[model samples]
Target: MDKNKNHVSIWCIVSLTSIPLIMTLGNSMLIPVLPILEDKVGITSFQSSMIITSYSVAAIFLIPVAGYLSDRFGRKVVILPSLILALIGGLIAGFASWKMDDPYTMIIIGRIIQGIGAAGAMPIVLPLVGDLYQDDDEKISSTLGIIETSNTFGKVLSPILGSVFAAILWFLPFFSISALSLISIALIFFFVKVPKDKDEPLKFKQFIRNTKEVFKDEGRWLYTVFLNGVLVMLILFSMLFFLSENLEKVHDIKGIKKGFVLAIPLLLLCISSYISGRKIKGDLSRIKKIIVVSLIAMSISIVFVGYTSKKLILLLIVTSIVGIAIGALLPALDTIITDNIRKELRGTVSSFYSSARFIGVAAGPPIMSLVMKNYLNISYITAGILGLILLLFVFKFIKVDEIGKSKEPA
Candidate 1:
C-alpha cells in the first residue's frame, strides 16, 4: 500500500467526527431532563429512565444488521439513510410534545425510531475509520482517540445543552436534537468519501464460516475486549445516571446548574481520552498496561463513591477519577479490535463489539434506578467488583503479540 494513499483528508475528519458527536447529543442530552420529565409529564422515576433505555434497546437489536449491510454495500450508503431516519424520529417526538396534551407515549415511540437510526450511524464509524487508513496503525489509533474524544466531548456538552433548551420548554431538547441531526446529515452526505467496496459479498453460510474462523483463532483476546467494552460503557452510563438523579434529589440542583455539575467529570473524561488515544499508538503492550492500571483506579474510585455520598465535592472528585479511568480504557479497546481485524470482516466484527457496548448503555440507567431505590451503596460496590473481574480477564487472557497475527483457523 502506498503511504501517500493513507493520508487522511480534512473533510474526512470533519464528516466522520460529526457522527459520534451527534449520536451522543441525541442520547445523553436526555439525562439532565429526567427529573423535569417526572413533573411535566407525570411519569415515575423508572419511567423517566425508559426515555434513555428505549433508544438504546432499538439500537442494540438493529446495529448488527446495519453492520452487515455496510459490509455488503458501503459505509456512506448505509449512514446517510440512518441519519435521515434519526431526524424524522426527532421531529416526531418534538411535534408531539409541542401539540399534544400528554405526549409521553409518543415521545417513547419517537425515541425508538431514533435508536433504530442510531444503530446504523455511530456503530459503523470504527470500521469506516479502519477502512480510511488501512495501512497506517498510528493514524488509526490517533483517529480512534479523536473519535472517542468527540464522543466524550458530546457528553460534556449534552447536559448543558439539554438544560438550556429545557429551561425554555420541557420539549425543546427534542427539537434541538432534530436540528443537529439535519446538519450532520448534510455534512456526511457532501464531504465523507468512503472508498468503494470491490470484494464479492459472501453467502450467508460462507460468511458465518468466516466469522467463526476469525473468532476461533482470535477469540482468546477478542472476546475479552468485547466484554470489557460492555463493562466500560455499563459503568460509565450507570454512574452518570446515578449522579444526575442524586444532584437533583439530594442537593436541590436542577436545570443548567445541574448540567454544569454533570459536565465536571465528563470534561475530565474527554481530556483523558484524547491523551490516551494518542499515546497508545498501536502498541499492544501499552494498551495492556493502561487497561490494568485504569481498571484498578476505577474500582477504587467507585468504591469510594459508595462511602462519600454525603460530601458532594468528595463524590465529584471520585467520579472524576472514574471518568479518567474509563477515558483511558476506551481507546485502548478500540485500538485492539480495529488493529486486529481483517479489513473485509472489520465492519461486522466491530459492529458486534459495538452492539455489546450498546447493551450496557441500554441497561445502565434502569439498573441504576432500581439500585438507587433499594440501596445506593450496592450500585457502587457492584461496579467495583465488575471492574476487578474485567481486570482479571485482561491479565489472564489478553496477549499483546498474539493479536493481529496469523490467518483464521480453518
Candidate 2:
C-alpha cells in the first residue's frame, strides 16, 4: 500500500465527508421545521411538503446530466461550482424565511437551486473519491463509509438543531445550513484535488452512443440493485416525515425535544453505517445476499413503526433496525454498482444511481402522506409491500452470480 494511498489526510477525508453532511443537513434540518413553516409561512401541509420535493425534483432532472458533464468536463469543475450554488441557495432560502416574510415560494426556489447544486456536489463526490483511490478497493469503501457517516451524522443532528433553532427563531435553521455551505465551499477549494480521466472527452452525440453501448449489455442485477437503493431512500424519507410529524402532534413534543426524537433513527443509522462499511463483502454474490436481508429488515422495521402507538422506546427500536438496514444497504449496494461500471463512465453511472435515489426522495413523503391520510395503516403496509416486491424482483430478474463479474462496456 502506498503510504500516501491510505493517507488521504483526516482533514481531506473530513472535507470530502462534509459535502454530504452539508447536503443531508439541508434535508434533515427541514423535517422538524416543516410544521413550524406551515404555521409561519401560512401554507397548507402540501405546500410545505413541496419544500422537500423541490430539492429532489431538481436532483432527479439534473444529476444524470451533471454526472455526464463531470465525466467529460472533470469532477472539480462540477463540484466547486455546485458548492457555490449550494451556498447561494442557502442564502436565498435563509433570507426569504428571515427578512422577506413571504410565502414558501421563495424558499422553494432556493431549494430548487440547492437541488441543482446538489446534483453536482453529492453524486460527483463518490466518483471523485474513486478517481483518487483507483487501486485500493478497501480504502475507497472506507472513504465512502466516512462520507456516508458524515451524511447520516448530519441527518442525526439536523432535526435536533432545527428544533432548537425553531425555539429561538423559525429561520435559524436555514441560516445554520447556510453557514455550513459557506464553510464547505471554502474547504473544497482548499483541499480537494480533481483527477483527470485519460480517455477522450465525450461529446453529446458520442455520450449517447456510449450510453447505448452500455445499455445493450447492462446487467439485470444492476437495475434490481438500483431500484432497491431507490426504495430504501423512499422508505427512509417516509420514516423521517412520519416520525417528525407524529412526535410534534401526537406526542406533543416541541423544540429540541421534538428534534431529539427525530434524531433517534439518524443516530442509529450513523452507528450502523460505520459497522456496515467495514464489514462489506467484496464478492458480489455475498453482497447480494446482504442486500436481500437488509431489504427485509428495512420492511419489517418500517411496518413496525406504523403499527406502534405513542411509545417512544418501541419507535426507537424500530428506527434503529431501519438504520441498520440502511447502513448496510448503501455502501454495499454502491460498491456493487461501482465495481460493475467502467471507470471511464463512473460519474455518469453514479449520477444515474443518485437520480434513482432522488426520485425516491421526491416521491416518498408526499405519497406516504397521501396514503396515511386515506388509511392510517397504509403507509407501513405500502412500504412493506414495496420492500417485498423489491426483494422478489431481485430474485426473479437478476442472476445472483452475474453482478460485478464483467465491466460494463461504454
Best by TM-score: 1
Error of 1 at 305 (Å): 1.6
100 in model 2: Cα distance from truth in Å?
2.4
Give Cα-based local distance difference scores for all models. 0.88, 0.80
TM-score result, candidate 2: 0.94
Model 2 has an lDDT value of 0.80
Q: Candidate 1: lDDT over CA atoms?
A: 0.88
lDDT of 1 by residue, 268-327 (tens): 999999999999998889999999999999887888876776689998999999999989
lDDT of 2 by residue, 148-195 (tens): 778788889888888888889888777787788889878888887655
Indicate which candidate wins on lDDT.
1
Model 1 TM: 0.97
Candidate 2 — which residues are off by over 4 angstroms? 1-7, 397-400, 405-410
Off by over 4 Å in 1: 1-3, 406-410
Rate residue 181 of model 1 by lDDT: 87
Which ten-residue region of model 1 has the weakest summed lDDT?
401-410
